[model samples]
Target: MKDLSYACSKFPAVSDPTADEVRRLRAEEKLSVRQIRARTGLGRNRVHELLRGVPPPEWTRRPNAKDGLRAEAVELRGQGCSVNDIAQRLGVANSTAYQWIRHLPLDADEETAARRRAHSKVMTDARWAAHRAARDEAQAATHRAAAGVVGALTERDLLLLGAAIYWCEGSKSKPWRRQDHVQFVNSDARLLGLFLRFLETCGVDRNMPTYRMSIHESADVAAAEQWWVHTLQLPATRFQRPTLKRHRPTIRYNTQEEYHGCLVIDVPRSRELYWRIEGLVAGLGAAIT
Candidate 1:
């Protein structure tokens, strides 16, 4: 390499003195990457490359965190133990054990058996299932705690929340054309339910929202229609003819059975409600800041 600076950057500046100092500490002092970075003003990447140029010491004679487990790992590998077995026995990570045993010699049968064990579907599936269970438990606990924090929403609280949701997801007026209508469209059943509750809090009549399903023509249109109908419990009279989106070659990932499409809830002649929602959203901004 021409210079450390040249290696690190596209265009080298006047040779950096700090790079030389890092090299001196790395070579002469035999300092580790962490120590070099802590003891010098040089960056981590700069320090890393400098140390990487030198061969690792034949033996890490110095005591380390892994010193207790290293001998056991080596012994296990010599006895034809797989990396996973060594890791489990030594209470070290699989990657850590692999790094220590990677250069060790393995007989043909031992290597083949290890590879087969590693690729076993039952073991892999069990590991993944356990990990997913733990993850789901932790996530559900967090959600429960968060839900407890928001014990209940009063009418005013619901009003503010609905306005914020409407501002974020509902249709709005543009500068070119003035269209003040309270129209909310979403694929999420939970969000639509919350919006419905918000509408009730705003003194909107229960039968006010006109429902329309916007879905792909190729989807189970009747099933989607039934799902929305069952979800809202609104009369068939309030339902508009479902707007079918033409199938396109570019469209992907939305052809699954669970893809019920989006429901558009419109309150015709809702100019006053739209303005009120806008004001509520503005008030929320003022209150938040």
Candidate 2:
């Protein structure tokens, strides 16, 4: 037997200050990885190597949001959830979910496996249903909040809104040709009403618009005409002959009871109105720029 004390005395153990500080920070001071990194100016990889076999303090282990998610994943795994099941329930990626609960063994017989699958299916369906309900509620809440923001529309607001819509949906005079007059067409009844209100706001109360219907030839044209006349309180004689669109079987069009096709509103001597809308639109563009 060699005397280890005599050999050790000949070759003395060297004291490492970096290792000593790392150990002191980890053991005595109980500093977190981030704190130790800042204090010692050590790279993350070096710190991790130094931290081997030393479990982090309980505060570090539990306080993180990711740790909370991992805990939830472990709980779900215990309840017989697979990796995909955990991903769906936690709104996490399947890969991330797998890493969280990989150590947990799924010990089950064939019967238990089948039972787990059925439970997973039921839970998946329930999760989707709940998600849809929550999404609808969030959408409705956002809509109501936005509607509340617009308590009342002044004339200026209507002018701006009307100009934008007309630019989008109405006839605009092209440089190659001319749109000539202010003409708007749309299938949305509420939109048509808003345009009319916009016209009234612009003091075009006397120029009663001649309504035109552009309906599918296959549709009952008379029924749609009568509905539009009654709905818009239009004088029966003011409505022009409807332009029929030839139906194609390849492209399916709405043939529901509520389908009224589209309405075309033409104003007489609306050259001034056209220019006004153009100016408003141009002003809007300039204001944004």
Candidate 3:
């Protein structure tokens, strides 16, 4: 590299370029500040100050109307005009408007600020309570609606529905000790009936095996089994024993109580049937969408 001092001495410095010219050259030619400084032999700081369109440090400083406009910007922010809107009204950039308004409080007086904060707290509380109430009501409505439809399924219907539910959602395969026995495990007795109806639709034999119940460890396992046996008119010998999973505090087992657990249905020839059912589901989705 050439000695910068010698280069500066060789080229006598002219008046600094105008800010408009600097910006235009930077945009059109994509020249760096260092490149401009090297070519003109101007000091790096001087080049930067010129590029920014600010006066050099030697120039006297004075607060002007622009400072007053910043105060107006703060007032407008308190009134809820967004930074972009304020910038447009003041003929300044959005970033400059934001910088002016960021430190100012939303309310000018202590009383007004406190009142606004209190109102915000009340509104937040109301919203949360309303949300929780709505969620509970919706869950109750679902339970009621499910109850109405679940009581009418016959034993054959239950078996077929259970089979279909298993085929769609359960883990099953011939290689994995062929789960040929049909079992419908659910905490909700009503939903169990619906699942059994779905099984009947799929043509599963009702007499092949009796429906069994399984629930979370926290639930009344024996009571749940008895409910299933009595509701379905199955003999005690036909009722398979219920399995209870241990409860963990961190584990979210909402489905264990509410949703019917995976139904183990007897599908003696399930490989081809599984694919057919999958294709039917895919076709239905495509048709509906």
Query: Of the candidates shown, which would achieve the greatest lDDT relative to the real structure?
Result: 2
lDDT of 2 by residue, 99-122 (tens): 999998665577877887799899
Instruction: Please report the TM-score between candidate 1 and the true structure.
Output: 0.57
Model 1: CA > 4 A from native: 1-123
Show the colliding residue pairs in model 2: none
Q: Rank the candidates by lDDT, best first.
A: 2, 1, 3
Computed on alpha carbons, the lDDT of every model, listed in order, comes to 0.84, 0.88, 0.62
The CA-based lDDT of model 2 is what?
A: 0.88
In model 3, what lDDT does residue 90 have? 93
> How displaced is residue 278 in candidate 1, in Å?
1.0
What TM-score, computed on C-alpha atoms, does each candidate reach? 0.57, 0.53, 0.35
Candidate 1 colliding pairs: none
Mind giving the per-residue lDDT tens digits that candidate 3 earns over 130-180?
A: 888999999999999989987775755544555455555555436758543
How far out, in Å, is residue 266 in model 1?
A: 0.7
